[model samples]
Target: METRIRSEARSYLFVPGNRPERFAKALLAGADAVIVDLEDAVAPHDKDRAREAVLRALPELASVYVRINAADTCWFDEDVGAFAAHPAVQGLVVPKAANTEALAHIDSRSHARLALLPLIESAAAFTALDAICHAPRVERLLFGTVDFQLDTGFGGDGEELSYFRSQMTLASRLANIGSPVDGVTMALDDAGEIFDAARRAQRFGFGGKLCIHPKQIAPTHDAFTPTEADLAWATRVLRAAQGSAGSATVVDGKLIDVPVIERARMILARAR
Candidate 1:
């Protein structure tokens, strides 16, 4: 199968693999992509059941992903081995991907032309961001906020994790991949908290936010999509640059350059 990286505005929703009833609903829930999670979402006793359910439901899925457990765990080998033959699985969101060796091993074994989105949770992974992104199979980097917070011993909100988040985003850009994805906001019932956290992620240059519940999808998408005002401004900026010779130009009394132009084009493309 031909593989493509996730380019559109992303609001990936995670559904527990054992919950087959929620699988169909998640696909129809208007998320950019659905992540059938067998890792954190599944209890120890339910791992086998979740795997079977996900395999059974794969044939019916239109656009979604399967997040298997970490490769270091007892279930990791089984998880990858079981799904190796499934063609419908679009990509693998590998959790706690500490190095390129793990990614190489997974890619070498899988038959599917599966893209990899490595989860950068540990300090080791963060420190090795360059080598990880250079891995031929990696397509994007996903920041695992909660795991990161725990790994770093940060308490309360995730203010302490900003440096790591910024570093991952920069690494992804330098590696010439799609924008980095922000981790999920775990407060499922509170829309206000979800929006605030997602917005903060956006400000930090995250292209998307992961969602644990379907209810968070719409709000996350809305927060990520560019507004009409933003589009209009981008258009004016580009028009101003049309007659300029230098690398930078003035737009709306502000300086604009290649980065600004690129961001403007991204907004307009998504708006289209």
Candidate 2:
């Protein structure tokens, strides 16, 4: 059976694994989830040490996820064996994930119940999107926009990435998983930029965003939250749809059908 994808987290803050000192601070920063990164964030020389530090600190952490090195890396097996079954680990963020075999391998190593958040970062990953989504223990897909750009030679994050973003969202929807998480915005202190980027991601059907800093959390949440006008419209849509008794209805001069009603309910769900 596929793992249940029920996480409603809208902000995932990444803390470098080697920097154990920042673990508590990231958790308390109010991100819906904290990712203890052991992949790109950690330098090659520090890989072993970072894994050691993260494993040692797992008991002190609460419901945290770990971004382990890619399945092809020499360190992958050790990282899996060390933390996959640890109670403190809520999930494992598998970076550069492209196939079901890799996900199955990770699942096999774990003795504890855990979700797998696969990073869709390469063209290869896009080709195998469905396979990755339906892989064992997989729960959510995360768009690694930066790496994807690098891998594909995409020139910019805007139009160049729109189609890719849509593909990720569409694949997740087809797999019945939570909407994929968007990549991080580079701005650390610009709330407006962060909020705009997040809003764009939301429009593209992403449920959350990756954060490199704690400051991005609040703005990310603000972007995902339904506005007053949105809530009111959703309420109106729901009320009107309720009286239709399975028939299409009219609301605000537009036809309200099953899809529109579902959209309204989704807006209200996000608001709540």
Candidate 3:
């Protein structure tokens, strides 16, 4: 089986694992993938029930990604074991993944086709980015902004987090994995805020944004999609460069170099 990541995914919606009824609804919510969160979202008392619900829903939720509890926790072992035989899960999202040991453990339980997405949040995880990205079955890393802020005592989310975001991008590219996914936008109903946050992450080289609610999926996808203005500019640049025959040409007072032309081509490609 070929272990692959969903490169075209722009939005990932989270649904609590205990709610099996909402599992189907989440897939229908228009997200590229639905994540059944067993950590943070599920209470300690309901861990067993949530795990049971998630395992049962996997076959029905084709694109579902399960967020299992950390390896240090008791439920972690059981979470991976339950999903091991199912193989219907597209991916497993491990929160606060800081070492290779846990990844190896989960890899031993699951089939070869299951992709691993480590949610890098702790300072220790940051230092161990290379190991985590290179771990067996690791498809990509997901930035946990809210938890990271709490972990690192960082207050601002804009510039303060760029360093971590850049590290995620660089490490993933070097590891030859899919682009890292950015953290979620807390403002659920505000499309403007969600779009801005996702656009910033995309500029930082992220390929996807985490969605806390269904309303955020559309705004997140729109942020990653090329706009009409971008398409128009790319078209103009392509036309000018076509006649220039690779020679340095000026378009809108800017020299159209190889890198500039490449960006234009990317925009046009995304438009298609």
Candidate 4:
């Protein structure tokens, strides 16, 4: 239940709950986490079957996260009831998360056993970010970039969404939640594009990226990992700052202040 232990996870790969046949493949795909999706991935007619399918699959599989339907949907309660106490469930990836009251209800239903990953996908969610982050058992926030664009009428996902992305990061920091996760890259065949997008998310202060395809995993991990040069620079910074006795020092011609030293430590920690 100490979900913060997983705050450093870099990739969350989504697998359709209705397609149980693909579960094993996804679990072995080397993602930081595998999310069995019962939300947007499942068709209406298959929702009940998907729920049952997950119930059967959970026993045979290792613990994995489940992305359930939003609280507004009829399927929401059923999804929570079925998986709240399931031993094989690591947590619930709650979609379209906005209301803190509903989040409290979900926590009660789960008896606080499951971690909540609130997907910040709408304007309403942005407005209530701090409240949602502070909601009971919320382990992390996820950026639902695609749905957010549709909801907010953004024509593109580039610089247009920068402000909102930063807001999510700031809200997460204020709430002491894990750095928010970035949404998926639509390109399945292009690892370069996926890597670029993941790097962009990292620049915006996101801790992870959602992966729709297994192919996206390696590049995503590569993007999040500190490069050799970065590690070397961080090492130099730490060495330079040592024995400074709280005084500022110089590293690579730049003044190594407390913030710079702290940043170096973070970079080294990430490398580890």
Candidate 5:
């Protein structure tokens, strides 16, 4: 059932938990999903109030993903008991998940119906990527590139994170999970830059992107969607394969095999 959300969602707009007023506006913002954040976006002193505000707002929220604090934080355990079992919270985004133990610990407290999204941040997470990806109730992984750069001492923008982003896309596919969502773009009101960043991630195999504001949602969605040319090419490729009786076919100077045909079908499916 979580696949329903993963397939259709190309943009997740985040709203700080403490700001209940913006939550409604965010839900109305046309983002694929609204993530009520209780993690990095909220202040340490405000955790309690934010959690309460989120819980109070959950039933009113149709379908929302709540991002909980790190597993090791003082607020972590309390967060799980408070909302992991709540009927109104459709999903929980677990931050700083660096190992199977962390996931296991959270899983021990979380309900099976609750989709879990683990943020890959720390260097230790890279070492335990396999385990983290397959953990119980895991819907998908999310690349926390900003936090990752801080952890790994990497010093460039999206370019420096290409290899890492590629690994995330590969890992998700290997685990039969949906493509991971890329981190946020800090720049504001620059749709072109946001679209370019999102398109780069999409080309690298990411399925969605995180948005800090509603204004980024539309451009991010635009980036992930296939263009008319792509739809046309996929249509031609599939038609060629069908006519060839699933045998090898040459289209536009490229050989179309089973894998290539399958990719074409997927592109067309997404286009629909």
Candidate 6:
């Protein structure tokens, strides 16, 4: 197996593959990774054009992935074909991935050593997550909140879709994969709302968030990365528990245990 690509911060910015101008800008915008979206963002008639543009730009990206249409889409085969031919492509984000078979096809066809980030958007896909993640190419699970809400008739409020989001995270953990990505916060201008949403997702074991706009990237990264205070507290807790074992350790009058230690280590790792 290829070594997993670990993201230091948890903000992924989406840029339209058709818009060549935004490609370099997104990479420079400090997002942990840039997802060059060829599906949804591109018009049906422009799919071929967008594919060409993306192929031309792939060589310029530092860390990037392509979001292809689902396997059943008319353009799915073309999307995979284009990616397979591009040696610069590092990863692929398959939207609305329904099962392992779709991923298996991608694995069998891809010539480029690309990791798979499956976007779980439908109820059926959620149910099939266990089998889906077991696919050889799958690296991370990404929740597609907007499409999911549309498919399930769920509301946008965080509470309404909490269960689904949690299920995705739990499934990723069970599969021993990288942390699941929370869906994007659609409020582009509301930094406060974006921050709150990212933090909430973090609490739910989501290691990262998908972002639509460049403005949302900074706040999302901030929300996921450990703050100075957080790092200090974590360092202190680890030191206090250096020679200790058992269920808990008291740090600054607060009790800490395995769960707390695990969280602290995650914070420290992100810090590094």
TM-scores for candidates 1 onward, in order: 0.89, 0.94, 0.94, 0.95, 0.93, 0.91
CA deviation > 4 Å runs, candidate 5: 1-8
Clashes of 4: 0
The candidate that wins on lDDT is 2
Candidate 1: regions farther than 4 A off: 1-6, 242-250, 255-259
- Model 4 Cα lDDT, one tens digit per residue, 1-272: 32342367899999999999999999899999999999999999999999999999998766688999999899999999998777678788999987796688778877435788989899999889889988877888999999999999998888999999899889888777789899999999999999999999999999999999999999999999999999999999988888687788888888889889999999999988
Evaluate model 6: give its TM-score.
0.91
Evaluate all candidate structures by whole-model CA lDDT and list the values in order.
0.81, 0.90, 0.87, 0.89, 0.86, 0.84
Which parts of model 4 are misplaced by more than 4 Å? Answer: 1-6, 243-245
By lDDT, the candidates rank as 2, 4, 3, 5, 6, 1
Lowest summed lDDT over 10 consecutive residues: which window, candidate 5?
1-10
Instruction: Write down the RMSD of candidate 1 (Cα, Å).
Output: 3.0
For candidate 5, write residues 1-272 as lDDT tens digits: 22422445798899999999888999999998889999988999999999999888887896799999997889988898898878778788889888877667767776657788899987898888878778877778888888988999999657888888888888887777778999989987999999999999899998899999888988998898889998888889989988999678899999989888888899888877
Worst 10 residues of 4 by lDDT: 1-10
| lDDT at residue 179 of model 2 (Cα atoms) | 88
Kindly indicate the candidate among 2 and 6 with the higher TM-score: 2
Backbone clash pairs for candidate 6 read none
Mind giving the per-residue lDDT tens digits that candidate 6 earns over 81-195? 8885466777889998888877888888875567889998888998898887777767788988889889999878489988877787787777777888988887999999999
Scored against the true structure, residue 159 in model 3 reaches a CA lDDT of 99
Candidate 6: residue 225 lDDT (0-100): 80
Q: Candidate order by TM-score, highest to lowest?
A: 4, 2, 3, 5, 6, 1
Q: Which one is best on TM-score?
A: 4
- Superposed by TM-score, candidate 6 places the C-alpha of residue 48 at a distance from the truth, in angstroms, of 0.7
lDDT tens string, model 3, 74-149? 9998988887546688789998888888888888888768888999888999889998988888888899999899
Residues 99-179 of candidate 1: C-alpha lDDT, one tens digit per residue: 887788778777556777889888789779998877866778888878877887778446777787788778877877777
State the lDDT at 18 in candidate 3.
88
